[model samples]
Target: MKALLSSRPVLWFLFLFNLVVAAVAPFAVDGTQGLVTAAGMGAVSLGAGAGLLRGHGQGA
Candidate 1:
């Protein structure tokens, strides 16, 4: 369970999930824009994935 929680796949999954939520946030609001938020979330996810990949390499 600990291994699964710390896995890169899990990290990536969470990041992607956040991105998806950000993308859909605009529709939830009456007049809010979601593109910028989505873009920011995407950037964060990309960075997280990259960081996880790098950490995995160092451990192996």
Candidate 2:
């Protein structure tokens, strides 16, 4: 778990995936659908950032 959490590649992949989702969310839907999609994308980014911050301060 520590090894995976510390990996830069995994973090980068998550960041890129969230970015792509946010980019496409507006055009792919409307009304509540677009709002929900955008919220989900934001949540993923916030969660990933929080996880990275927490992992950085963790000690063995």
Candidate 3:
């Protein structure tokens, strides 16, 4: 379980999911607020992924 959590593939999958969210949010939700919220979420996800990559197996 610890190994899986630190896997690069998992991080890539998360990034890809965020990309999809960025693409779909505009059409699925109305108003600028949704986009801003999604962008904020994306930034957090990106930061998390970066941290995981930087720390590598440290957390595990």
Candidate 4:
């Protein structure tokens, strides 16, 4: 588990993929529902995922 967490490629992939989904998902829908989901996903990826990525890079 620690080994996997330390893997840069895997961490980067997870980070970028979630970010992409957050960016593109809003456009995939046409109503307030889409906007709400996008906001939630964006917060998770840009907020939480960013913290993970930063901690990983800093070896925290």
Best lDDT among the predictions, by candidate number: 2
Cand. 1 Cα-lDDT: 0.70
Q: Scored by CA lDDT, what does every candidate get?
A: 0.70, 0.74, 0.73, 0.70
lDDT of 4 by residue, 1-60 (tens): 967854666666666777787788788987887788777777766654665656764653
Candidate 1: clashing pairs of residues: none
Error of 2 at 39 (Å): 0.3
Residue 23 miss distance in model 4 (angstroms): 1.2
> Which regions in candidate 2 have their CA more than 4 angstroms from the true location?
1-8, 58-60
Tens-place lDDT digits, model 1, residues 4-41? 75677787786788767677767764453566676677
Sorted on lDDT, best first, the list reads 2, 3, 1, 4
Candidate 2 lDDT, 1-60, residue by residue in tens: 967855656766776688678778878887788878878887786777766777786664
**TM-score quality measure for candidate 2:** 0.61
Ranking by TM-score: 2, 4, 3, 1
Q: Can you tell me which runs of candidate 3 are displaced by over 4 Å?
A: 1-3, 48-60
Residue 39, model 1: lDDT of 64
Predicted structure 1: clash tally: 0
Which residue pairs in model 3 clash with each other?
Answer: none
What TM-score does candidate 1 get on C-alpha atoms?
0.52
Candidate 1, poorest ten consecutive residues by summed lDDT: 28-37
